[model samples]
Target: MGRTLGVIAATIAAVTFLTGSQATAQQATSSTLTMQGYGWKLTDIVGVYAISPSETYTITFETAAMKARYAPYYTEALKQIRDAGIHIEIGGVEPVDINQCGPKNHIQVTERYRPVGTPGWSKGVPCPWQPQGLGRGGLVIYNSEYWDGSWYISKANLHNTIVHEVLHAMGLNHPNVDLDGDGTVEPYECVATSYGNKPIMCSPSGGYHTSNMGKLVHFDVSGLKALLANARAQGIS
Candidate 1:
């Protein structure tokens, strides 16, 4: 896990300033940015999505055609999240299950392709009253259509996606940066990195294509750190 984090750190350290098109999207602190439609919000993390800092949140995978094949990707993503200082753990599997999500403390990983606007999406289990409130647990659904495409998405990309969506299940949203000043957020427009951009939460187009991308970037770690800090404030830890 440390090695995975080290790779991301090195990648961020090596990122050079943007030259032409991407120059407008300068690297900004995650603490100040908000999702475009979410009203001048800071980073996408919310207090309700936080898990008990004192507990290891268990994660399970539902039986699906892709579960065995893609389980490792989700597993690696969880390790990377844990490495980022968010407490989490893997749990049991339910065979031939279909949306019996429960317990409100465990995460269920499943596969499905829901192309609403992006390739993947996640929702906290038991549902939260508002997008900003606390959520006890969640669901991570992989868009298999995006995964099986011919677009040459590397294992790094898969891992990045898993990490990104899992963070969403924990109540993180896309780190929006309206680089064009159109009063709208664009995908892959968050904090900049050497290759172009960073931030696993950068929407459909963020993160490096290199091995470094498989791990959480600096901003991602910061977001989780912020969540943990909030947990402390709420007396969850």
Candidate 2:
């Protein structure tokens, strides 16, 4: 496992993505989580963060109504993570005071029904100087635009969007590989598998579509395990 991680790290660092080109890449400055190669500012190359098994991270919604509305979607997303055998209890439905939503550990999800081409259309962790590490949670602003009629996205897309953004808060970055022969990493450029095209961490636009959306592939689980293993190695458990 150590050998494999070493290879992955080296390969990721070696392949340079086109900086400031893709929408997600352009968001480098304002977001808490960096793009592609730089996993999380709080975590190391080994994928260790300040997270722990006993910690119960609360994922509150921008409004209680939104939470209730998206309840089933959230449940399915949580089930994917929990089913991976990772010890993390994640579920909550509370309307945080607009003023109180600025805390580091206060993880809230907002709704901005922006157009598809907008810069932050489906982005998360908007704050530039957000808290680092596991103990200090983050924010996720999903594009409610996707929830409207089938202009661009579907419910499955929205579900994956939730998982993707939440994972970013947990210190995951886009697995931005140069899938195409092109020298630059464009939007949705990630590893392809027999199952589908996108890894969950793929940015701006993720890989899976309606057919396989909301499913956690092996690559996704591996990312989580990488964090836990690194934490364990550091005697965090």
Candidate 3:
């Protein structure tokens, strides 16, 4: 059997931050800046998404299919996260122990490319949710039927999806909020510049979809920077 969390409550939840999607189970914070639809939100992490300043995440592909599908996006996303002072690398498969918050300091990602109506796709599983709430490593999946061209979404949406899910794996949750105070968080709820750019980490779906870049936005970078700050606080690095 895998290890147990004991008293941690294991509030392990999945996130994709548009206002109308996913979980908010044990997240410790929210976007304090409700910029009238132009703000950023944040959360406390509990996975291998962070370790210390000295260590690299070394994310890897579980299969060649997954590699072929997401290597480019991972390359784009990791560079931003890495540039922000968090160490990360696209690694080859080695001895990864992905048994529900295993302690191997590795993140393994796989794309299932399932068929339509196959429950769903695009899931991110971050590592241990400890009392300290820092990233150690975990698994990320974007097993959507869209990969096979069965589901039709724009390339921009696809790129944003990968970036969003991976951030979840890196331990960042959706920061969407009710800027309008409409009593409900809608898909368009999170931050948006005057030109309409939402955080890639926005739940449900949002990002630089106009250009099909699928890279992290400024708000997303703030979250990663927050991770580094938290890591420093906990003396991880």
Predicted model with the maximum TM-score? 3
**Model 1 steric clash pairs:** 15-194, 48-134, 48-135, 125-138
lDDT of 1 by residue, 41-90 (tens): 12222223334566667666776444565556556556666876767776
All models: lDDT? 0.51, 0.50, 0.60
Please provide, for model 2 over 1-237, each residue's C-alpha lDDT reduced to its tens digit, 9 standing for 90 to 100. 001222333433333421212233233223333223322222233232434444556677767767776555656557766765444444566554322334444467666655233633554442222222333455565666665653466556666776776665554556666657789866666675775556666655463676567665566666665555544544556
lDDT of 1: 0.51
Q: Using lDDT, rank the candidates from best to worst.
A: 3, 1, 2
TM-scores vs. true structure, each candidate: 0.67, 0.66, 0.75
Could you give candidate 3's per-residue lDDT for residues 1-237 as a string of tens digits? Answer: 011112111434333221211233234223421111234433343333234577877778766766777778777777788888988887775433334543455677766555112333466656655434556676665655665667676778778877776676666667778789979976557877677887886766778866546788888887777766666665666
State the lDDT at 217 in candidate 1.
Answer: 66
Better of 1 and 2 by TM-score: 1
* Model 2 TM-score, 2 decimals: 0.66
Worst 10 residues of 1 by lDDT: 1-10
The deviation in Å at residue 4 for candidate 1 is: 28
Model 1 misplaced regions, further than 4 Å: 1-49, 64-67, 95-101, 115-126, 130-132, 147-155
